[model samples]
Every structure is written in C-alpha cells, then in structure tokens.
Target: MKAERRTQWLRGVLDLCILGVLYDGEYYGYAISQRLEQAGLGHIKGGTLYPLLARLEEMSLVTSRWTVRQQGPGRKYYVLTEQGRRVFEEQASDWTMFAEHVATLIYRRGE
Candidate 1:
C-alpha cells in the first residue's frame, strides 16, 4: 500500500502501537521505527512517534534513559513504566475484544 494510505490507516492508533512495541522491550527512536517498518508498519514516522513518546512520558506511563553501546551510537531508550504495563494489559484486552467484533463484522458483512 501507499505510504499516505498506510499513514491514514495508522492515524489514531499510533500511541497504542508504540506502547505495544515498547512492551516487547526497551528501544531507542530509530530502532523502534525500524522495528515497526520491519513489521510492515512503514508508515509510522518520527513526526508521529516522538510526540507520542513525549506524551506517554508526561503521563508517567513510560520512562526513558540513555544507553551507550560500543557497536553503534549512544541512544535514548524507552521502556514501559509499571503503570504502563498495567495499562498495556488493559488496553490489550480491550483491543482483543474490539478486534474480534470488527473481524466478525467484516466476515459477515455480505450476509
């Protein structure tokens, strides 16, 4: 799909998407973006991601720290806070239920 179309598809879900990604483990901005791209979420960009990271940090749902690695450059990594983990659990449940409902609708739409 085109980048613009993909961007439209991901508009309102960017925050949750980022949270879900961070749930996997801590990651810096570039690595996070790269992972999303690798996962076929190429539309997600720094413009959309950094602001959400800032907001999540402001809400105390995530914490960040700088990590220096010998293999590459030092980067600021983000991880979910305890509160974030709890929220992730709740949001994941909600997303699961919502997705099932939407899937059913899509599957039965022509019936």
Candidate 2:
C-alpha cells in the first residue's frame, strides 16, 4: 500500500522525534538529516531543520560546536543539553500516549 501523507501536526511531532535522535549522540546537519530520512521522515526539509536547530539552541535545548576534520571542512555538531534530555523524556512519554490514542482512533475508523 502507498504511504499516507503527513499533516502539519505530524511534522510538529517530528521535531520532537528529531530532538530525541540528537539526544542519543552529537550529529552534524547532514547526519541528522540522513538519520531522520532513515527513520522514514524523507519529507522533512532543510528549511525546517535549520530553523528547528536554531530554535533548540535558543531555547537551551541543544548546543552546537564547530569542528574541523582533516578529511573535510568544518561542521557544526549538535548535542542535547541537560535540559534537552529532560525535555526529551517528557516529550517521549507524551508522544507515546498520544500516538497510542491516535492509533486506536484510526483503527476504529478503519473498522
């Protein structure tokens, strides 16, 4: 079956998902983008991601550090702050509950 289109609300939910991934480890923009795509969020755009990263940094949810590698140019790496970890925990709990409820609604609607 074809995949369903994601709504704006789902995109907002994905911001939390993205943050959750970064909470696991530090990652650069391309790596984060690739990770999200691997997790089945190919619809996300750089436009959205850059703004989200900036917002996260502004909110103290994440911090970025620039690094230069011998093989390539410098890149800004992002990692979750202590506050981000706590926020991730809270958001994960909330997402799980909301998703379960939404799943039930969808299943019932289909039935």
Candidate 3:
C-alpha cells in the first residue's frame, strides 16, 4: 500500500531527519520523537527512536547525558557533536540533490 511504501521511504531517511532535529540543539528521546511528529514525520515510537539514538551515539555522531528532573526520573538528552554537524551538512546536501533529481524525473513532461 502507499502508506507502507511511505513508511519505508521515511525509514530510509530517518537518520537525516533526526540529525536535522538535533541540529537546533539537544533533546531527550521523547522530545525528539515529538518534534519529528510535529515536523510531519508522524508518530515515531520510542522503540524505533531509542535504537537510532544509540546507533548515532555509537557512531560518535551524538553525545548524551542524564539530567535528573525534580518530579520524576532523569532523562537522557542528546546533543550533536562536531562530527555530527559535518556529517549532517554533507548528508543534507546530498539529500537535496537526490530529491531534486527524483522530483524532476517524477514530474518530467512526455516528449
């Protein structure tokens, strides 16, 4: 179905989307998910978001720290590293070019 294909496409670029969100500043897991949803990414679950965060951390693209809140347990906040910024910049450029090409192909006029 179209929805399923859309989900697959979204997954393919989820990392870039996450990096874009983090580019602004640090965010906790829940906050990241919410921001992505607000940005039209739809409802991304904790299961999916957490593992990606872990992978980004493992790749040294992001760093995290636990901040204790007054009313509840601590939350782990993630921030983009210098390397992440570079990666994001490169990836964003690549994505823009790729998207333009795809759009052109999709909208091409018949000769």
Which lDDT values do the candidates have, in the order given? 0.86, 0.85, 0.94
lDDT of 1: 0.86
- Model 1 C-alpha lDDT per residue in residues 23-102, reported as the tens digit of each score: 99999998888888888777456887888899999999999999878997889999999999899889889888988998
lDDT, candidate 3, 1-20, per-residue tens? 47788689988999999999
Residue-level lDDT for 100 in candidate 3: 100
Model 3: how far residue 27 lies from native, Å: 0.4
| Model 1 spans > 4 angstroms off | 2-5, 69-73
Clashes of 3: 0
- Cα RMSDs of all predictions? 2.0, 2.4, 1.3
Best by TM-score: 3
Clashing pairs in 1: none
What order do you get sorting by TM-score, best first?
Answer: 3, 2, 1
lDDT of 3 at 98: 99
Q: Return the top candidate by lDDT.
A: 3
Task: Please give each candidate's TM-score.
Answer: 0.85, 0.87, 0.95
TM-score for candidate 3: 0.95
> Residue 67, candidate 1: how far off, in angstroms?
2.9
